[model samples]
Each structure stands twice: as structure tokens, then as C-alpha cells.
Target: MFKQLFETGIGVIAIAMLSWILIWMTRQARFLKAEITDSIKNALGEDNRADWGIFSLIFIAVFWEGLETALFIVAKFQEGWTPVLGAIAGLGVAVIIGMLLFKWSIRINLNQFFQVMGVFLLLIVSGLVISVLRHLDAAAIAFSHISSSTDLCGIGKNSCILRPQIWDFSASLADRQFLGILLKTIFGYTQKLYLIQAVGYLLFWTIVGSLYFRSLSQSTQLKPANKFN
Candidate 1:
């Protein structure tokens, strides 16, 4: 019981942190370059070691990206090796892209790149919102069983706390199936979905998605004006 609860808590924290980071990045996308430049300039002015300041800046940036990647991988660990493999593939692609952009001095539309990736991540995290709620519900059910609390879940209910099961598509497109697993990994698809889970998923996309797209649009609008000025 304790172990299940602990794992669930970790998953929740990891998903929450990932979601927060994604949304924050969307909102700060426009200012990130300027902020980094300013930070580097400030660091360089603090001492005579300009090279050391630059190195420090690079170290911090790499450390932050690594931390985010670690958290994401940890969050997906319960799903088995598939997601891990996918993450490794993604890292390779990212490295290649970085080399092209930085080392080869290739020009890419960073704003568009971020916009597309932001949308993809938001979809994934929205699914994660559902996953977190389901995990909490499972933990609650497990605790109720261990404690012998019959009242926690009424008879014939599929969930102890997530409300009645809305639908079970396991007979048709079971989550264990190849396509189902793909959807589950990419979009958080589930064979059994509860009312609360559906509501939570939609609410995440509605609120977080709105904020992200709004910020993205604002950034796009401001970019041209800033360039002209």
C-alpha cells in the first residue's frame, strides 16, 4: 500500500513539474533569448574571467535541459521500455538538430519549431493529467482495500474515487494493442476512462492550451514590431 502510494506521488510530482515547465516555456518563449543574453552579459561583467562566465552559463543551460529530460523519462518509466526507447531516439534527434543549428550555423525558424513542439507537449501533458488522476484513484482504492473500508467504494463501481466508468473500449481497441499503446504513449489514451479523468483531461487542455496559444500569438505579434524598432 505504501509503495503504491509512494510511486503514485512521484508520478504526480513528475507530471506536474513537466506540465509547469511546458506552460512556463510557452509563456516565456519570446523573452528567453534576451534573458539569457542579459544573464551572460551580467555574469561576464562581474569578473575578469569572461571565458569562465560563458562556461558557467553553458553549464547551467545544459544542466537544466538534462534535469527536464530526466524528469520526463522518470515519469514514463512505468510504461516499460518503449517510452524509454522513444526518449532515447528523441535525444538523438535533438542532438543532431543542435549540431546543425549551433555548430553548422544553420538557420531554422525557432518560433515555429517551438510552437509545434509546444502543441505536441501540451497534448501529451494533458494526457498525463488524466494519468495522474487515475493513479490517485488507484492509490485510494488500494488504501481502502488495505484498511477494509467498504464505504470508500460502493458496490458495482469501477473506481473508488474517480466516479463511474464512462466507457471501456478494451474489447475493441484495448490499450494493450499496438495502435492503442501508441496512442496511449503519444496522447494518453486509455481503455477504461472515468468521468473525472475525462473532465480533468479536457480542463487541462482548455485552460493550459488557451494560455499557451495566447502567449504564442502574443509573441508572434511582438516579434515583427521588435524587429522593426
Candidate 2:
């Protein structure tokens, strides 16, 4: 329980970090709604208004991320109070961290912040591959175990991808239980992993994140040392 809670909590924080980082890095927000938050501040003037605006945008975005998790819980489990409580707790932790950064006079470079957070995001992304693999593994186990067919012998075969089920827990990497479910929804997790799932996840990050970052590189402008995002 504790393990799932801890992993889930970290996962939520990582998601929050990734959200703000995306807000910072992308020059033109791909989504219309997200554009208003980041670029609006850039148009405001970096002195005081822009600074406050950036913070507000980040704050609102983080809130939205938390709210999304809360709503997801409500949608998944109609009367579940635990997910709501878990969402609040997870959001609270992220808020505290933000408060510390805002309150402290310590200054951090925007690019460096993204770089660090980006690395952390990558790590979590890798874990997602592991999670997907587990899901595929579950499918393989259930199909192979039940069926007498010898053709579906390979990992993540057609018999598995079409029907997924939990296969094992002794080596499960994901969190399970109430808090764990909250955490998983807030972050991203599956207790088990499979070969094909891991490869697909890797392709996603390698292709998508690279393209996103590449676009940012093309769009970036020369700015003062601390001003780069």
C-alpha cells in the first residue's frame, strides 16, 4: 500500500512538472486552450505583469491537471470518496512544493529547470513502457494458460493484445489498492509489463517527445540568460 502510494505520489508530481514544462517550452501551444496560458504572458511583458502571468498560467494549469484526475476518479467510480481525497492530497503536495519555490528567493534558470524536469519526465515515461509491457504480459498469460493452441506462444501475440488480464504480481512494478489506484490515475501505471508494450512506449516517447523538443528548438529566440524557456 505504502509502495503504491509513494510511486503514485511521485507520478503525480512528475505529471505536474511535465505539464508546466510543456507550458514553458512550446512556443505555440498545439491546443488552443493551452496557448492562452503561456503565450499570453509572453505578450504581457516580462517585467512584473508577465512574471505574475506566467505564474498564474502555471498555477491554473497545475490545478487543471489535478482537477482532471479528480474528475476521472468520479467518472470511474461513482461514489468513491477515496479518489477525491487522494486527488486533494496529491495536489496539496505539489502546491507545497510550488509554494516553497515561490517563497524562497532562490532563482532557477528556465532552460535548466526544464532540462532537469525533462529528465525526470523521461524516467517516468520509461516506467510507463514497463507498465504497458505488464498489461501485454497479462494478456499472454490468460490466453496461453487457458487455451490449448500452440500458435500463441510468443509474448504479446495476437491472442494477448486482443485480450489483456493480470498475469502475475510477484514482480509487479505498479502500485495497487485504494491509494495506489488514485496514484495510478493521477500518474500512469499498470502492475505488470510485456515486451511489445515496452517497445511501443519507447517508440512513442522517442518519436513524440523528440518532435516536440525539435519544434521548440526551431521556434526559440535569443533572450537574456535567465529568460530562456
Candidate 3:
């Protein structure tokens, strides 16, 4: 009972923080979009000292992203310190890439970079849905036991209404194995996947994929018209 409350409280707070950041970003999307576009084109060539506002905007944007990431990391601490290590490694790579881009005048297609990162983030969000469901299932089961009711489990002692394992691939690829761990971290692979978890993942991808493809189709349709002009 207490464990469930603890987990729920922490998870809720972390999600709320991240969601607030997301909403704030969305609300400031127009200004941020223009600012970032101009900043990238200038590539720090402009005298930031002259325009203190631009520097403040850049600092605030970076700080918000960093704060959101920190909250997300806390939310995912159940995945262990591997994710923290990965974040550190990724930060190093990002710093190196930024240096190379600025100092070396390396050409990078920002559109492609954002598209790839968007897809990666979508996958992570889907995985988080599964994680949330898994946690909810545990809490529900715990509550059922305390209340002396089998409502959460449904049919049997081992059977859970929300988290009944749909399939187990542990025989073929153990989740503890290196490959399994890699997939789990990257793509949220599970040896014992639950029904609700699968549903949530599939539903998320389905909706997101439809919207993404539709946007791509619209962009493709508009490109020729722009070129003709």
C-alpha cells in the first residue's frame, strides 16, 4: 500500500514537471522557432553581447530542456544507472558535434537531424506508456491484496487483469542477456510482455505514425509548388 503510494506520487510529480515544460514550450513555439532558426543560420557569428535578449533566450531554452531531461531521468530511474551513463555519453557526443559544426563549419541538414530525433523520442514515449501500465498493474495488484479482493487479478492467483503476460520470449532470448538488455534499453523490448503494455505501445505508434505520414505527404505535395514559384 505504502509502496504503491510512493511510486504513484513520484511518478505523478515527475510527469507533471515534464508536461508543464512541454506545454510551456508549445505555447512559446512561434517565438522559439524563429529564434532557433535565426540562431542556427548565424551560428554564433553575430555579436551576442550586443543583443543580450538573444543570449538570455538561448540560455532559458537550454535550461528548460535540461530541467525536463532531469525530470525524465528521475522518472526512469527504475531502469537503473545505465540510462544515466548513456545520457552522459550522449551529452559528450553532442558537445563534440556542436564544436565540430561551429569550429569546422561542417554542413549538417538540421531538418534530417530533427526528423530522426523526433522518431526516437516517439519510440521512447511509447516505451514510457508501457512502463506506466506496468507500474499501475503492480499497484492495482497490491491494492487488491490489501483489500482482500480478487478484482484486480480476475480469475486466478497468478492472473492479473491488467498485466497478464501475453507472451514470453525468455526461452529464445533471455532479457538478462546482452542483446536483450540493449533492445530493452533502446526499444523497450520485453521477454514477458503484457497485454495492456502491447496495446498501449501499438496504439501510440499507430496514431503517431498516421499523423507523421500525413504531415510528410502534405510537405511533399507543397514542395513542388514552392519550387515552381
Q: Find the candidate with the highest lDDT and give its number.
A: 1
> How much does candidate 3 score in TM-score?
0.60
lDDT of candidate 1 over 1-229, digit per residue (tens): 6666676688678767877787787777668877978977886788779868678879999999999999999999999998899899999999998999899998776667778898888888888777777778877777677676455876555688888789999999999999999999888899999999989888887887887788777777776454322
In terms of lDDT, model 1 sits at 0.81
Candidate 2 similarity to native, TM-score? 0.42
TM-score of each: 0.67, 0.42, 0.60
> After superposition, which runs of candidate 3 have C-alpha atoms over 4 Å from their true positions?
1-53, 56-92, 149-159, 171-186, 219-229
Rank the candidate models, highest TM-score first.
1, 3, 2
Q: Write the per-residue lDDT of candidate 2 for residues 44-139, one digit (tens) a residue.
A: 765666767668989999899878877777785665876577666877998787887798755666555665676566556655545544444455
Specify the poorest-scoring 10-residue window by lDDT in model 3.
Answer: 220-229
Candidate 3 residue lDDT tens string, 109-211: 6545655665676666566566566667777777787676446676455435455678889999877898988777766677788787888788867765455
> Which pairs clash in model 2?
133-193, 133-194, 134-192, 134-193, 134-194
lDDT of 3 at 180: 86
Using lDDT, rank the candidates from best to worst: 1, 3, 2
lDDT for each candidate structure: 0.81, 0.57, 0.66
